[model samples]
Target: MPISDFRKKKLLYVFNVFFDVNQSGTIEKKDFELAIEKICTLRGWTPNNPKYAETHETMIKIWDGLRQRADANKDGQVSVDEWCSMWDDYAQNPDRALEWQSRYMNFMFDLEDASNDGSIDVDEFTTVCSCYGLQATECKTAFNKMSKGKEVVSRDEFQELWKQFFSSEDASTPGNFIFGKTNF
Candidate 1:
C-alpha cells in the first residue's frame, strides 16, 4: 500500500527536523554521528563509559540498517526521496520494519530516561529534545501531549506511542508529537 499524505508529512518532518542533523538535506553517517555526539553529551557519557559505548554502537547499527535499506542509489546517503520511498514500502506493514524501528524507539526512550526509572518525566524529555536542537518550550508542550497529563510516561506507554508514531494515520493521536509538532 502507498503511504498516506498525513504519514508522508510526518515522515518528512522526521527527515527534515530529526534525521538531517547537520541540515544537509540528506541522511548520512555524519548526521548519525552528530546525533550520537549530542546524545552522549546530554547523558554526560564519554568514551570511557559503558553507556556511551553501547549508545554509540546502537546508533551506528541503526545508521547501517538505514543506509542498507534506504540508500536506494548506494551513494552513502539517503535523500528525501529515498527516505519517503523506503517508508512507503514500510507503510504497507509497519511490523516488517519493527526490527530496526524498535531499536531506535528503545534507544530514544532510554536516552530520555536519564533517571533510569523506566519512565520519562517532562524535564528529562525536554533536556533530550533540546540536545537535538528543539526548543525546550516546544519539547515541554510536546511532552504534555504525549504523556496525556501523566506525571511521567512509562516504558509501555512510550512503546505504544512509538508504534503509533510509525503506523497511525489519525491526526489526534498523541504519537503525532513523538518527535514534537511538525509545522505541517
Candidate 2:
C-alpha cells in the first residue's frame, strides 16, 4: 500500500533524526534538540532558549498534547504500544499532513520543557543532556559561572550561547547542498 503524505513527512522527520544519531546508535538529547532546531528553522519558528526551555510547566503542556494523541483511550499516560500506534497513524495521514507536522514541532518544544514547570531548571537541563548522551556537568558548570543573580537562563542569553555552541566554520555558506548526505 502507498504511504500517506502525513506518514511520509513523519517518517522523514524520524529518518532524519535516526540518520543523524545512527553513528552512536542512540538518540540523545543533543540529537533531539538539533532535530527540533532544524524543524523550527524549516517552519520559520524560533526555538525556545535552551536554558529555560525545559521547565516543568512547558513539559507538562507538551506531554499533555502528546498524550492526547498517543493515549486514544483518554489515559493520563501512554504505554509503549499506544505511543507506537500514534506514531504509525501520524506517518500515514496524507490528508492531515500539515496538522501532523505542527503537532510534531510543538511536541519537540514541550519535550525540552522536561519539568512541567513554567520555568526550566538545572534538572531539566540535565535531562535534556541525558537525552543526547551528553553530560550535563559542563552545562552546569558554565551556567553556574554565568548565572550570578537569575535562577533561569534568559532566552536571549541562551540563544546567543547556543548559536556559538552549534556554529561551524562551514555554517556561513548557504545552499552548499550536497546530495545523499543525510546528516545535518
Candidate 3:
C-alpha cells in the first residue's frame, strides 16, 4: 500500500525529532523534550490539561526507553561513543536494531521496579529520568507529576507502549529495521 500523506508526515516528524536530538552526537533529555514539543505542536497534540510539569513528566517516561539503550554501560549518562555505538549497530544489522529495542523495553521495566524489592515507585521514576540526562531536581519534579495517583505500568502496559512508540509501516523494507516487526 502506498503511504498516506498523514502517516508520511508523522513518520517524518518522528525522524526529524530523533535527528535533531542526535545531531550533536549526544542525546540530552532537554533536547529530547525540545524535539517532542516541536513534533507535538506541529501535530496539534495538546495534553489533557496542558500543564508544563505534566507534559515534561510524561516525556521523561518515554525517554526512559531510549536513554537506557544509549547508556549501554549503565553509567547513568549517555556518552557520544555510546550513542554512536547504538546508531552504528542499528545501521549495520537488522538483528542489532531489534536487540536494541528489546533492551530499551527491558530497561523501562527495570527502572519502574521500585523498592529495590522489585516494585515500581516514585523514586525509580525519578531515577529513570535522571538516567536520560535530566538533572536530579528536574527528574524529581517530573516524577512527582507522573507518579501522582498512577499505578506502575504492568508488563502488558509496557509492551503496549513499546509497540505503540516503535511500530512503523515500513516493516517490509529489507534493509530497514522496524522496531517490533524485525526479529533479531
Candidate topping lDDT: 1
Q: For candidate 1, lDDT tens digit of each residue in 88-138?
A: 776577666646677888888888889999999999999887766778899
TM-score of each: 0.90, 0.31, 0.35
lDDT of 3 by residue, 1-115 (tens): 3444433443343333343365544556766578556544533457653544444565576567657777787765566556545544443443334544665455455545545
Model 3 worst lDDT run, 10 consecutive residues: 175-184
Model 3 off-target regions past 4 Å?
Answer: 1-25, 49-59, 72-77, 91-184
Residue ranges of candidate 1 with Cα displaced over 4 Å: none
Please give, for residues 22-101, the per-residue lDDT of candidate 2 as tens digits. 43433333444455554344334554655344332343454456556665666454443454455555445423433433
Off by over 4 Å in 2: 1-19, 24-110, 116-118, 145-149, 167-184
Give the range of the ten consecutive residues with the poorest summed lDDT in model 1. 175-184
Which residue pairs overlap in candidate 1's backbone?
Answer: none
Root mean square deviation (Cα) for candidate 3: 14.2
Whole-model lDDT per candidate? 0.84, 0.41, 0.47
Q: Model 1 Cα displacement at 127 (Å)? A: 0.9
Please give the TM-score that candidate 1 achieves against the real structure: 0.90
